[model samples]
Target chain A: MTVTSLPHDAALSARHPGELGLRESATFDRATIADIQRAAATGVYDIRGWGAKRSVPHFDDLLFLGASMSRYPLEGYRERCDTDIVLGDRHASKPLHLQTPVTIAGMSFGALSANAKEALGRGASEVGTSTTTGDGGMTPEERGQSKHLVYQYLPSRYGMNPDDLRKADAIEIVLGQGAKPGGGGMLLGQKITERVAGMRTLPVGIDQRSASRHPDWTGPDDLEIKIGELREITDWKKPIYVKVGASRPYYDTALAVKSGADVIVVDGMQGGTAATQQVFIENVGIPTLAAIPQAVQALQELGVHRKVQLIVSGGIRTGADVAKAMALGADAVAIGTAALIALGDNDPRYAAEYAALGSAAGYYDDFQDGRDPAGISTQDPELSSRLDPVAGGRRIANYLRVLTMEAQTIARACGKSHLRNLEPEDLVALTIEAAAMARVPLAGTSWIPGAR
Target chain B: MVTLIGTETPAYVPAASGATATLVDLAESTVRDLNQALHEPHVQGEWTVTNSDGKHSIAVGIDAPVSVTIEGHVGYYAAGMHQKGDVIIRGNAGVGLAENIMSGTVHVTGDASQSAAATGHGGLVVIDGNAGARCGISMKGVDIVVGGSIGHMSAFMAQAGRLVVCGDAGDALGDSIYEARIYVKGTVASLGADCVEKPMGGEHLEELGQLLAAAGRTEQPSEFKRYGSARNLYHFHVDNSTAY
Candidate 1:
């Protein structure tokens, strides 16, 4: 075979049949080849952290339609375009009034370092938003640092307590996550420290599998009763949020609303997880941009559109993404992977450490294996101490502030005073797929691809 | 003598116990009011609740060290998250009875629905009759004793606990169980993922005997079989994980 060095992005030239030539097969890319080889060497499929890396129609495919001659735009500096949102105003006696549309998503104390969990709490608190407790339950540092906290009632029920339920500003009943919908969560033994083990009531070092479905209830009817039970337990004070993976968002949203959810959190395919099978992460669930339209349609059909708040998540990074999500009829948006990055995860400064672990800084996805050099996803005392919660918290808070400001800027450009006022009319899609998924008109055209 | 509280219903307060016995009737009092009364600070008493009539969430979230007795059938989550209390339900229990309980003793006189004593931390749950599917699911450091048969998926993902079943067990008996000892006396239909029947040793037999005695059972400990994790998939070993 003949070998030639070419630019990374340059296309391979076709050679005559007589000449010695080979072209990289489109069906077998480098990643697929490597995966095949790896699977050949080992019998098991890969398990990794983070979300889907495959190319899909995302928020980047959509663009905001700024004000024109027909419409007037608000001044960027002088205009007071509000970003405030009210969650769980439907049935909750005391609803959460957030100053920003961005809230921190759930990441467990066991999956993350205590410092990282505290940092999330501190950051969300600083930004007048809420941080959630994940699979292993609430930690003292998180509860103390967070101004508004949302306790996740997951199927695992790890370290769940009634006192903590009362302590929370809101309660989120997690039915499924986006990364691995209808699949259980996996926490490998290496990350299970004594504290984590104690909190979860497991052995010091053991693999823990969080159940896919809830233990008690099998269907939506039982869910309605469970919600009632929770309301009665909390004296109808704390807002109840129901979260679901973005598979069948239309039906899920309708059922969640029927089950008396104050807020419906829809997590899409691009959502991050601490650990899951790579197959599930890539193959399962719909995209965030696609999930929102169906969820809104469901809520509209049920005649409870804004009464029960909608929070969309998965691959949300910048202010533009936040604005787009809201324009698609979401009341709020949640950030998980981006929030961890703001807390200094995958920083290039730890390049050497990551390399030693057979991975690079940008390529570090071994959160389940637990020897995270970044200190955010590990349980090692020495490694965990590398992170200062206060400093990390400040960084996250600043990032959140920037995201909020950026979203406000976009809202003002659309001539909308409040973030919620930015409707679907203020947006356009760059591609046919995006236009169809987002239910928005094509750029420089009046037609939405899939609209009847 | 019966005393009225806030013109709602007549509550029977036993004078013999010197304000220690507070009898509540579910016919007149709501579960919310009863739970509110239980949550009151420094409220120490033996709460005798009558006419439950299959109501859900009876005596839920009781934190105090009080004794609660439900005279009739109760519905789902009958002592859920109960902390430091002695709760006795005289009749059948619905789904998720004593779920997420922390440091308490809950007794169900009749049969229990699915997921009995689920995710409980540091508690003792005794069911006199058969338990439905997913009993003791995700149990954490809780001791559960069932007098009769238990349905499928019992002890699933159980982190740390002892599930003592005096009678037969259904399919997928200990699927994905973690470190929790499942002792079953009667027939076992099947074992689940990563779960295997381990030989019953002296310590296990003695422990089973003690649990049986605590559960007020006459079954011999020698008749039981113990099951637990095979320790595969502990660290994501490629070849070992193929069985999953």
Candidate 2:
């Protein structure tokens, strides 16, 4: 039982693992060993925030082909490349007409502070986009700040109000998110403040476990009746959105449409959660790149590709990701983890405080602890007050502008007048796995791995 | 076989509340049309629906201060999301009867399917006949009075409200119940995790009596037993794994 240990001050010194003739086992990794020890010690699996940390083939593996010798290109600065998108116009008389195709995804108030929710609303409103209210139901601050608010209809039905339903711009029925496809929401007792408890109708400082299955309805068959009921309740005015984790994308999308959804939101594996089992987050659901084509194929088979809009989410970051999603046949893209980043979560400016909490700025994922140094994911009055909603909103608006502009730059270069016009023909995959998932041709070749 | 039981009229009419009620025949028109008429902002007086042969969503989402009477059997979500209205179903109701009701009253004279009055924020739901599984599930601040027995999982995860059952309760009665109070006059099949029997004090008896009277039931409060949450599984712990 001889164990080779590092020198006592090796971390402070210049000596490296490789230099010390040591090799780290990829299978029996340090992180894996630590995780085993953690499980053995606590007898409970790790439950934390954020999405899948493992590497998967993503949008970065695909490259865009700018207009070349045979094709033409639009002027970068002057030519009009439209980024405007309309969602849920099929049945909704009042569909959301936004200036950009990037929208903010639903993040609950219990997971994030009220200030953060307000900031997200203000940010989305500034850019003529929509923000959504999550499981704790709609808060006044969020509703007041958001111009176009989508009230989420979760199984919990916490703080669900008829008055708020009428006030919302649209209704999104959430089947599951990508982080934990079959799991329910978790707001540990530490984060459950008096206000959160009042809203959730639970005792103060109690761990709230939301139900995974909806109380009334079951599968797609019952979902159809449920959608109809909602339509009747809202007078057929608000758009009905069906959101699902990207597991069986084609079947889910088709079923959603059959269930009378005007809009379908598909969240891929990289989608973030406030708090969930680590195993579930990493194990369930497919990646964003693989999900788009299947969802699009379903819509295309039903002759409602763009008619019944598709909003792809989970790990969408830069304008490239947005453009890649649209090119792969999504009507729009939603940002959750990236939106929190824009709101100053995990910022290096809070490095000292995050380190004091036994986490670094970029590595902090203990959102369930409810002691966020960035103040974006905590309910503590002092911690939440650190974030000024107005200023945070400005940062988000700026980030959104960058993403939209970068997407427009690519669209103009590809000779597309509108973002929706960008197609798979303009894309080439850098890797075979990516080509197979994206259903695109490999770089410098005419072959699509799976199709060929 | 789309038979017209009555003469079809426009979906929505102007504000007019006469002694003669607004008559809507499901066979003559469609469920969408009936709902549109109910949604009319200035709607007043009573609405009488006929030929409701297991038609779903009959007289749903009535927001105005009005009364509706469905003459025949109705399907799922009858009088759902009810606010400021009084709806009476003369026959059996399918699943999700009066779901998410905000205010007003929904009375189902015959038996109801699953999830009756589930997630109701506020209001009173009276089921004169037996209610199927998950009746009053996740109820929030809504009073549900069942004259007959309720099936399995009744009052499961009920948040805040009073559920008065005049007859026997099926399996897992009041499972994971929160602040909601359940008073059952008949024998219970089983108690769910974290749900336990509690002695009915004077206040509970008074409350049960009030609810029974409001629901127009003559059941004596003394015959009923109260069940509530034990507050043990409220916080997460390893010892509660079996309960979970």
Candidate 3:
């Protein structure tokens, strides 16, 4: 085959020998150019918070197929629709029973303030769902407030203790995160407070790099041994959840199941991070919309679908997103960035403070700096005092209520009694990418892009 | 408070101190049953687990300050996440021995497998024999001492406390270590990441001496070389990519 230059590239190359203007077919975009210049100016790679900013296939690319002439619709006001869910029923004596499928995602205390963590606990408790503790370990404030708490067992094992493990309602073994799969966690010196340092047994004001791989087990076989150890440690009382970034959901899900996990948590490309290299955040892992079907297929192929619960996270913003995720076979959905917003992370009310930080309310993503104007992601005492946990908890509770109600509304309109009953047949994709990923038909047609 | 005499099953002997002493024979009891009996509220007693048979996760999640002695070889994660207890393993231990321990003491009389005493906090762990790879990995405020040589990557990313290796250390000793002090009496194959050899100052000598005493070793502090963090990668810099 012959390689032919595009018209724009040919025209640009014709004048590039003396031109001061940018090339029409420039390989680097404005953002890429900025990143390159920044890297050249500062030797270190850029580290920040938040998930993939560039657009990809997402829930918005799909829509629900509402009841029409051929299908009878339920009365919206009189119909009853359920949104309840149960997790960890496989082996745990006491499983998690939630009023809704929406639950809080894991966010560490060091990355967030004590008040913010408390708010998450309170909000999740009010809705009869669960809240999770991230990398640094569980805090007293979080445990006292959350009705059901899931303790994260990361590769770092920071502050991991038997007492905390026993106190946890469930245990989540973190393999990786969506923002930076195959990458370690980073907590800059600025965020390491005295309490945080003491808890993690690190010196104050020192940067910490959590290990990417677990110290004990290496592969799936070793993982099975480790899972048995965890079960014995907890006396087979607490449920074990294996969480992984959605890079190879099918394989990861199968391995997790084989390792005797009671639940599987898949976080996709859009999952938020407290701090990480910007390149890893922007260019790692598959999208949530694409990860769900792969994970479901793995569970189904293993004959463990719904027997082992699946909780999908990453850029899940609304009740519509939750409904779509469940319709695609996710048992539940988790939220992090959106929950922070409910707790006032980037409220327009903090616009003046955001301006002082050289950013706007809606555009802020520098959670790693620990100078957050909204006080949600800071270790500074004065800044952390700005947030009120009680009020924040109330706001989050209201948001959760809205999401549950909206999901119920959709389920009723679809003539379904339970959210889990809203199957893939009740949905249609607006784009070929979403259609293929979700394994659903395209709008106004019976054609599926890549179905067997 | 009942003692069963020697019969077809093993005998349950009670201690003279009047504290309830529970005897668990692995030949007849399950790990779940033993752990459940140990976790009972207000059950303050001594526990002796016999015939461990190299089983993984023996005497794990012990919350109260109890004394537990294992008579034979134990498998992976032996005494894992132990707190407020004294656990003694009479035979060789498997991988991740005493891992993630908090506020407890785990004593292994024989050789230990990989990742021994990893991520422990507020505890003391003593391994009388050689330790495998990643010994004391990510240790936090937990003092660990290996009476014999240690395998590769000992004290990797250890955040605090002291690691005393009476014998030689394998390659990549103390890789990416932070704050934790390492003392090795024998040769070190290599250093890794941001780890380096540091001068054993007067304060370090005193500290090493104390760690040696705690680990029940009579070796001279001066005989060991001290290793610690170089503080090069403490803060992120692209120039430090080689260390990463």
Q: Which candidate ranks first by lDDT, i.e. highest?
A: 2
Question: In candidate 3, which residue pairs get closer than 3 Å at backbone N, Cα or C atoms, i.e. clash?
Answer: none
lDDT to native, each model: 0.88, 0.90, 0.88
Candidate 1 regions with alpha-carbon error over 4 angstroms: A1-22, B1-20, B198-206, B220-223, B238-242
User: TM-scores across all candidates?
Assistant: 0.93, 0.95, 0.93
lDDT per residue for candidate 1 within B100-204, as digits (tens), equals: 888879999999999999988878999999999999988888899999999998988887879998889999988877888999888999988889999998999
lDDT of 3 by residue, A1-452 (tens): 12243344656655553263434435786678888998889877888898889898999999999888875667776877878898999988878888889999999999999999999999999988899999998999999999999999999988787778889999999999889889888899999989998887778888888999999878888888888888888878889999999999999999999989999999999999999998899888999999999999999999999999999999999889999999999999999999999988888998998899877989888999999988899999899898899988898899998988888788777888888888898899999899998889999898888787
lDDT of 1 at A320: 96
Show where candidate 3 strays beyond 4 Å.
A1-26, B1-21
State the weakest 10-residue window (summed lDDT) of model 2 chain A. A1-10
Kindly give the stretch of ten consecutive residues in candidate 1 chain A with the minimal lDDT sum: A9-18
Give the Cα error of residue B141 in candidate 1, in Å: 1.4
DockQ of each: 0.61, 0.67, 0.69
User: Interface RMSDs of all predictions?
Assistant: 1.6, 1.2, 1.3
* Residue pairs with clashing backbones, model 1: none
Q: Write the per-residue lDDT of candidate 1 for residues A1-452, one digit (tens) a residue.
A: 45554443323445442343556677997779988998898877788889888888999999998899988999998988998999998988899999998999988998999999999999999989989999988999999999989999999888898899999999999998899778877788888889998888877787777788998787788899788778877878899999999999999999999888999999999999998989999999989989999999999999999999999999999999999999999999999999999987889999999999988988888889888888999999899999999999999899999999999999999898999998999899999999999999889998898799
Model 1: DockQ vs. true structure = 0.61
For model 2, fnat equals 0.71
- Give every candidate's TM-score on chain A: 0.95, 0.97, 0.93
Winning candidate number (DockQ)? 3
